[model samples]
Target: MHPSRALRYALTLLLLPLGNALAAQVQVAVASNFTAPMREIAGRFERDTGHQARLAFGATGKFYAQIRNGAPFEVLLSADDTTPGRLEQEGAAIPGSRFTYAVGRLVLWSPTAGLVQDGPDLLRKGDFRHLAMANPKTAPYGAAALATLEHLGLVDTLSGRLVQGENIAQTHQFVASGNAQLGFIALSQVAKDGRIATGSGWVVPTDIHPAIRQEAVLLTKGQDNPAAKALLDYLAQPQIRALIQSYGYGLE
Candidate 1:
């Protein structure tokens, strides 16, 4: 072989392993409320680091059960801090590997104009046939919505009219598809560029419910995974945090 050709072949062999190392994939279980921002962040992560993220978006409660049952998630981005804490205690996640990444806001949203005004008053009147919300037992956003209703003294009155979705994403769908007149959804899902992208919504007062402190954790399956750790670190970057904030989430 010519000396130049031999040198080029040697370099290619040496670089192959490094390229493979940079292309690691991390499997992440993310809350449905974080779907949009996570997608954007994952794209940026892949572009910037050459590490890919495989995301599964759903209810945190469901993810918890799956993780406990040996699901193959390397990381979890929960809609509430409680779930990650519980996972850490249960040994489903790495101890002390969790941190609050974002604080989420809840909103009473309606796709139709004039259908929702003075959010609490609309509930008090109980004029709407179907009011959508996520399954409070499975979704933190649902729990927050329920807490807000309880705070407003409208839970019992509105119970009969409530329509439950499996997750926050579905809750938004229920309202958007006209299956329900209005619903409580994560601000991140409906807002873009710091404003509601469509329909009308009222940002629920924080005092009405517990703060939705969203957290991210390294699952036990990811303890030794460099890609997983890198993704977590990337999420904490100032630029990434700003991107998350622009999607209607507050930084912790």
Candidate 2:
């Protein structure tokens, strides 16, 4: 090999490790309702940007407490806008770094066909032995479900038969596994290609419950992290917004 070519090859080899070193891995705390879509987006992000997103899925309220107590998460994808806003106010998140990512829809779901009707009458009729919902204190979707029950005047009558899950994902499992005849869950949990994929469900009206405006924010730990910023930017892309919508969420 020529002397110049040999020096150039050596330099290229030396820079390879440095490139790998700069590829950051961001720690993200994600809401359980966004589990599926986040997984897809995270994979694409890593592939396209050479940055990894290490995700932890759980209840938004619980994640909020953890972040406040010094959790090392670089980003927070909360199920409700309130939590992210509060984090900004409390200095847990970077100021003005928050944005609405998706609008979540609440649904009443059952594994059995025709078990859920188009309206709220089924909940009032009390035909099912049990109804599952996430813990309202921990999950936004759970809070929405409660609001819906209250709006339909079923809270007093159905509280006795209600089963609670720690998060919306678990609440979905409870109904999918037949542990509960029916359950309230995020539409994303059971929807695909703009429709419910299996079983039966009622798309609860917005008026019945408060809007589930999901939001994402950069945490204090991620303020200077390039990977964290990249993920946030990637989420705001039109293609990604369309992908989120395909999962049964509305886009802002």
Most accurate candidate by lDDT: 2
| Candidate 2 per-residue lDDT over residues 148-232, each given as its tens digit | 9998888999989999999999999999999999999999999998688899999998888999999999999999887887788
Worst 10 residues of 1 by lDDT: 1-10
The lDDT, on a scale of 0 to 1, for candidate 2 is 0.90
- Name model 2 segments beyond 4 Å from true: 1-18
Q: Candidate 1, residues 1-252: lDDT per residue as tens digits? A: 234434533443444457765467899999999999999999987777677899999999999999999999999999999999999998888987788899999999999877766888888888789999999999999999999999999888888999999999999999999999899999988898767888988899888899999999999999887678778877877788899999999886
Query: How many residue pairs collide in each prediction?
Result: 0, 0
Clash pairs (backbone) in predicted model 2: none
Per-residue error for 35 in candidate 1, Å, reads: 0.3
**Model 2: how large is the Cα RMSD against the reference?**
7.8
Please state the error at residue 137 of candidate 1 in Å: 0.8
TM-score of each: 0.91, 0.92
